[model samples]
Target: MKILDKLPYFIVAAFAWVAIVSSCANQGMPTGGPRDSIPPVLMSTQPEYKALNFSGEEVQLTFNEFIIPDAISEKLVISPPLESRPSILTKSKTLIIRFNEELKDSSTYSLDFKNSVVDNNERNELEGLRFSFSTGDVHDSLRVAGKIINGFNLEPEEESLVMLHKNLHDSAVYTLLPNYIAKTDKEGNFLISNIAPGEYHLFSINDLNNDLRYNEGAEKIAFADTLIVPDAEFHAEADTLTQGLDSMLIEGHTHFSPEPFFMRNFTENIYEQYVKKAERETKYKSTFVFNETVIDSFGIRPLNAETKDWYILEPNEEFDSLTVWIADTTLAANDTIPVEMSYFQLDSLEQFYLQTDTVELVFTEKKEESRRGRRGRNEDDEEEEGPEPVPQFNWTTNLSSSNFELNNDIVLTAPQPLAGIDTSAMLLYLKQDTLQTPLNFNFTKDTAAWRTYRIAYNWEPETSYTLVIDSAACINIYGITSKALESSFKTRAEDYYGSINLDLNNVPGDVLVQLLENADQEEVIREIKTDEDGTVVFDFLAPDKYKVKVIYDRNGNGKWDPGSYQDKFQPELVSYINEVIKVRSNWEWKHVWDLTPDPTFIKNIRDKELEEQQRKEAEEDARRESEQGTNQRQQQNNMFGPGGGISPGSLRPSGR
Candidate 1:
């Protein structure tokens, strides 16, 4: 009876052991094989690579492993560009390219992957894969390679479109698309392959609207005057292989050894003339603003012949702008002034033509309007019109030269016209211990600028002085009284400021030298045009680190012109000296720079900057890749086996 009762317990123990073993078998993960490191390999093509007389509607490429396309449309470059971009599709491990436009007869086509294909799981990229096909019997195996640089700064022009023109006419680039095109890399390097062996014109443009046309004044352009022939020598060489299936022997490829062509980019600014606006502040003054400075070939005539004598025309140096001063004081205050202006204006075709415009000038607030009442207004109704507003104004003293150059005088400007001043209420004193010495000074209005006044007194270095003006000391044209004012200042010490003596070598006349503050060469502290012998001196500069920039003025204009494409002008060259000069108190810093063009020196500077940028990007990519690998490994270890094992099926051989 005891043995039979223990039988149920034994059966229960056996069932419990079986359940525990089954659970353990299902819980553990399988150890995976080595992590995938090789990129997808191109096994075969439907119409073999470099296929001659190809007539297929679609091209197919079979890879050893499944691939995921990343920005394939953007990275793929098609030579002898199609009217419509082709469509790309993937089915398992095969990549399909469907033509959207008819292929040109007797033309060679090159499709470049530019490393857009990568393995699906590990995302390892395949580099430098290309396919070539010909619609006729033979293929053009030549290439044109070059570098593009900014004409002004000599910096690398990356992402610029380099084009080849078969028309060979200068005007053709403005209207037609290029025959073949390639984009410059970060290092300003570009190579267009499978070009026919013939003379071809080369040009580069930013292609802002992606139209491939040179839109005047809207895009930058770089052109090569001489035609190019793609007949350079090419040699075959074996490519270095990586680990895994990539280590297998591959066919050698031919590489072209072409002399690098250098190009400079520039933009043209064509002049457009038009009267932007015209302003009339008083009956005596009229200001005409042109799109640009106009110095001649423009006229303003009064509608009434008798008033013509009053017009005094004066144009600024720019020649695009002008101001008219009327000397006639007998004109009525509220008169409707009619005037006719004739000038050369730019038409839609950018051609200059004589155009006339009639304008009725309006002056809302005139000095005479406040002095006289309307013709029908009664004197008794003045109270209803409200008491005239008190003529209020602000005054500013031109202390720009207050650091007190010996030749500078204290200049004060008032918004309103000044009539007279009271010298008795004004005092000047030299600040001395207890006994302040009284100094003699003179005050007078400036002849040229009627609203400006000059206060003159002899100044000595390191001396403090004070000027005081009592209230109502000065009177204005509207009989307004002056406000009380007091000013005190001391001359700077002789050793407080420094100087810079620059010796420019090989300067092509009309260059501008500027002393710039800060490390970025901004904030112009002082600037001057080059004198004879290329000598420039800057005095009275505070202690600071300064940089120098020299602008090569090509047109002998005082200002630097960026450039204009329509005018066939290149921007003036700008050269920066490498050193940051430290100016010390009471010290003079002398610098010598050779402005002569040095091709090698300019290239080295640009190359160093490019290398630094590339290094940082490479480091960032490596860091991300390392992190991804670590996270993947950790996840496998936790979910699968301890050694991060994967199922055996995932390690199926990638047949190449």
Candidate 2:
């Protein structure tokens, strides 16, 4: 063995050292220890928990370990809640609570440390720890519990305030704070304990601003119709976990479980009347929007009515909106006209009272300037001015096809609000075989929509119809004339429409089924009411994807009512058949809806359908991959030729 042999051994030693160092570096930094799970434990307290005849101003709690006050001022709840929140402080392992108000006589007060006391280092919460004291001789121990959910959608409402009130007045919920309040948990469960048994009205409010009182616009509220009396019996039992039989044992008390109360919180939009805004949509047409519904048609006139008569008013059916037409042609483009409008509006008390508002009407954009071509001297002398271009207006319709159905109306909308209609210039013709016969039709303005007109005729199926409107058939507020337009449409065969047969189970007294485009959009294509047999047939439905929503009409009113808060009523229950029913042309879709089912049962059906669809897609993808692999193998065989290919006697042909 010479120097060369020694070099090989040295290289092997160097590699081994590098591998060991690399492996050691991969271990990274060391973790300290297992996580801390034990929360802070109470060692002692001044005037200890459940102290009787307590009149102290400050409570000092000492813990076994160092504790931190994590948002104790906000998280610490004093029940019945104090007039003012108390100040919380920490000194080493001790927590101090200083009450700013005097405690009531003979009343029990509980300071709930709802996870506010945490270990200093690990931040483990001391959950559900409470300190209770009676200012008088003994404590008044009674409990009430309930749950809260949204009125329309049955989703749990968290952090809502459930309160009790002794006063039976209907206005008490609006004017005064509650006697005892408890916030709802994440599951909408609430418990109010240590209450003196008495007759009390129960209500729940969102209390969004934390003002304690119910606010009409900012809060949602729910109330129970019947007065609740906390009379459930409770007894004490020996503590098994804390104390042994040989040790001095204290008893732990448990209350009897009562029928839990359920409340549906709802918000009402009280009638408040005010104009939202007035905007000029076109050159001579302006629209007005109101916060509340209007009772009558509004009057619009120029401020100087004696000099200007350009404005005319049209009120929509809902009375919440209206359009104003300015017919004065002398008004220049891009100009705004000031006018005063008078209308009957709802006041604070919901009475229709007359009110007036001033609005500014703006005109449309100015017309474009025309360019002139080069002209001879004679042509220039003759003045190359052409007749003023006709003010052009276009009309469009909401009809999907030229052939309108007997059930559908032909609605046409104008570019500007029309002041006058020339019905004689509009004609309808019925095409029977090869002969086109003239027919009479009536035109009426649709009061529900602005600048819309409906043409009605005795339409018959299996017949083609053509509608023709000559130029100047309608005159706008600016005196603009509509262009001549003609359209032809044919009616569809009766068999082309789809039908739906629904057999409902566990149906409420009255059921209202709404056929919607989808679950998310909620666009109702049609709605029908069914009888006790829970049988409903919806005919003449278009071929599309749809969902069925069933409303349990609890009040037998034939409609779903969102419950009134002050009236202490629960809203009507509603559920949807989550299965997406695809109705093809000339097809009939039938479904059975079970009303008395679990809330998530419909969602499960939808999820199962989705999973099945995914499974089919996966199989199709695998088939495609297999075909592609076969095609590649065929190409390889062709490239390699017969010599390189498998022998016919030994190989099997591919199967299709």
Candidate 3:
């Protein structure tokens, strides 16, 4: 009986322990006192930073906390870079690096670990870690700072390799590695410190093959036309635009010459022109494609058929490709057709020659449907066949609805290549109170479409109209004529459209302003060229979101062009207004775009804006993590059992 009395107390104590264990299990890993936001600090170095007469092949860095060398091979940049990558290892809080190549004598070597080392637990990144040592008695200490910019869009090019060449020859970029090098950070900003003061040429290479040298046609490169001499600023006045910049000191009151260099990044685009692909996809069509735009004579002809006009030639806007539509019925129905293609082919010596070849094009089919009927029925089926489709010409129109948009044209398209259209048999009528009135319209061929024709008419707003095309009005190359076709539609009112006017202040010469469909700026809805007064207007725009893009047509070619590195010409810069230009019904929006700032000024401000944007993103991420922690605690405290009571399942503790 005494033992039984103690059992009641034992059961009560067990229940109390169970409740505590359940609470802990649901809480997840403990908060552990906020987080380790502080990055690892460098406490000591092997031979002391900036030490002279450095003779060892190994370098070591000890930090205040444990560290991780995350992707050190890729992130560590050493100038006068080594021919081969070094081996990097971490032990506890120390990072050790062993060089594989010999170091240059009487030269200063600097290693920049741009945000590669991080604390062990929280992965806090240590930013802008640098170390310098010299093989001789003296160490170089001058610095140069600059940025790499995309030539076309004027955006910063991030993580590009900035190189300084002492040779200064044009061929040095292709032959030798740079004397001093540094990599751009996430913001496309780089600083090469501990450089010996001397005249140096600046260049940036994307380095796809990791050779540290520029490879034409395989890498993107930027060069500074003028050589840069790194010097210190003693008492120079700062520019007004740089008032918001952080004050950086090299020595005492010393700055990086107070003038940042800007490098224009571009591709040479000297890819050799060659046929990329050629194939016949259907019974009636074949396509041929080339790598680049064909600036010379390019032609294709059907060799199997004897008829002169065997196919209709259709060239893309770029003129680098052709779509051949077989017009001859015999050639179109052939199982295999031979065709001859002639085009300019580039040789290894960069010379073009007219080359011709004849090849056979054969159509293919999937295995399952190889012997099946048109409707996927087995060929051996003994079912009665239905009547064949009528031999009428297949054609379609854009009139899908009763209401018509004001900006659209009445288009008619046929499946096969069209031979001609009998305009005399076409009729357009104005329908009022069931009374038809003949209206004058133009049947014009749309240059941008294939096998298509457009009907041009000055349609009255809110008025219904009927269009009639008699039989045989449209004839295809196969001698088939279209059947009768009639459609009725009402034009939209003027109140459904909007207008936009732009006042371009301090505009550059020969500017092409384009209004886009959205902020993506992929499709241009309307475009206008600014006159000498720098004013352009776009009238009768439909209600939609829009954006504006301006291209500086420097060559007056009516389009934007990329730079030619060999010609020493920079690409024309493009500017964009990113605000959502919303067009509402019957509203006219006017905007004054100030183009006073040059392209360089625009690029510099854009870099700062991106920096501020990244800062806000970092803060938002921290807030979200904090809220998640609080939510987890609340979930632990409010957790309920499956059936509303602390039953066996809910009483499950940590281990048992």
Candidate 4:
């Protein structure tokens, strides 16, 4: 309500009017000149120009503008490398390099700055800067170039090591020292220059341990297989040895290592051998035979029990064999009993000998003494039963849902919850047709309480099939039996399929591509390798939604390699394109993928060879100099008496 409050409204109105007038005046008016395009320039060197026989410990290089340091040591190659690594400082406009070791005498040293200097703002690199100087004459100017490839996939392996050895032999570089080494760039290309050429053994290896040596176990190596020298050219191809997959379970019986078991008599031995006859039918079973000594002991036990009307044992006197018999009226497929012998002895020498079926008999023995006082009795004085019998579960499948599609996961839903069953005992099988025998199935338990189970099959299209769930295949908790079940179905036609094409960028040719269906994301539909152009295509895919994945394939192997924590190798980089495509009938879908770069370190072959040659020359020069010094000393000693040995006294007396 004060005059000041009304005055604020009037002031705001006046300011708004003034802003509108100013906006009208500034409309379409030119602001400033064009942006400056001047590149960064070098200002000065700390030691100044052509500083003769510069003996300073450090050199400072200053630029007109701020800059960032690239992989300095890796990108910066020093000919006649110093014993100690030079420290590079980039605190401000000045870049300083401090040397801790003395320089070689009368030698030309060249520092090849390969893309290690870049401007701070736009990261524009200054490539191929050479700093050359000589204490005596001129610098060496030899060069070498080569490509690096992955040992496993036979494709370009970026960031691998390419080394050169002065001495050539299969085991030389692997065991002995290498002269020099360098890392490959992202394109798997390398170049090394400023070298004094010499006979060298060129080798490329993925030195996983960074030991600068070709470790046969830890590194994959490729060599020219001969001595190489200046102006010589050669190509080396690296490939990995294929590893074998572990054995798969074929039938119900697994291979058994033999154990010793004694038999009561010849009849018992024969019975024991016959009991395992079914084991021979298994695909992986081997022939088994009982030792002669084991057979002899089987004849020693007394066969004292008499044959009853319900159970009988018939001996074949001529063949040393016995036939177990049960009265036809009481005998059944599931009925079984343990044969008792008159004599009590260790039965630990039984040997299996036979070829019949693939079924194994596993017996669980119950000692009478363990249950002696625990027997129960009824109120009427009759002994009560030990325990209630467990219920059995048997499965039956509808043929219509049995045939599996590549895109669709087949599910078997139980009609009711199973009771008192050992679900683990159940076996599933598939058959090409009703007339053909069944093939073993690898099934996994899905839900115990629901009695649900699932099996994933790498099924092909248009295949007729039958599924079988056998009776007596599963034993209940109380050892009750379940009846076998089976079904049959034919797959749909193959015309309902499609194909997919993937175009990948920045992806290695060795990258692995996998197709997965939407229904079972964890299940793989198919796996393919990317071509050199980074393109992967999957044909004959069933109609469904699918996802694509690309793995870096670090070893260039056509598969993903798992990382080991102990080795300190991180998991191979993986990228998912995340494009969900619905492949319809007779349709084709194309996808493009730009893979992310992996963190990798590789050696350059050309640089390594060049460095090796330079190192050898340096060593040879040092050796020659040492020999000359030794000879000069000996000559001086001879000129004077050995004891006088060019003493300062001799030189002073001559001057006086």
For lDDT, the strongest prediction is: 3
lDDT, candidate 3, 1-656, per-residue tens: 46666676667668886766676574677876987799999999988999999989989999999887866777999988888899998877899989988889989999898889898898999888898899999898888888887776567788899999999777888899888999987667889888887888888888988888888877788877777898876664555665567963333356666378777688877757778888888877888888887656787776756787777888887888778887777777777888788888778786888878887888754445434465576445635555555576856898854658776789998887877888988888986645666688878887987777898888777778888889888788878789898888898898988888888888768788888776332487777776354668887788887767788888887877776656777767777774567788899989888765355644322234456779999999999999999988766555544553344454333331
Report the lDDT tens digits of candidate 1 across residue range 1-656. 46676677666666665665465463657758888889888899988878899888888999999888656777787888777888999999999988998889999998878778888998998988889999999888899888988776567888898999999877888988789988887788888999888878888898898787888776888877677777855354544563356465545555554466877787766566677879787756778988765556687776765764665565656667676765555542536678788888778887887889998777766346444464566767776888775554455775532466543577778655556778888777875635656678878877655467888877777777777778777786556777777777777677878888988788767788888875432677777887346657888787887777777777777766665545454566777676566778999988777877443234332234446789999999999999999987777565455444443333333332
Candidate 2, which ten residues in sequence have the lowest lDDT sum? Answer: 647-656
- Summarize candidate 2's per-residue lDDT along 99-205 as a digit string, tens digits: 89997888887776767888988899887887888898888677788888776555678878888887778888788777787788777877777777788888889
* Model 3 stretches astray by more than 4 angstroms: 1-30, 236-252, 302-306, 364-387, 396-398, 424-433, 459-471, 483-493, 517-521, 542-544, 594-597, 601-656
Candidate 4 local lDDT, residue 539: 78
TM-score per candidate? 0.64, 0.66, 0.79, 0.41
Candidate 4 ranges beyond 4 A from true positions? 1-18, 21-59, 69-83, 104-114, 122-136, 169-180, 232-403, 406-470, 473-493, 498-540, 543-584, 587-656
The per-candidate count of clashes, in order, stands at 14, 3, 0, 26
lDDT of each: 0.74, 0.74, 0.79, 0.53
lDDT winner between candidates 3 and 4: 3
Tens-digit lDDT track of model 4 for 446-557: 6432345566566666776665555665553234467666655666666777889887787555777878765433367788776455667787687777766666777876
Candidate 1 lDDT at 605 equals 25
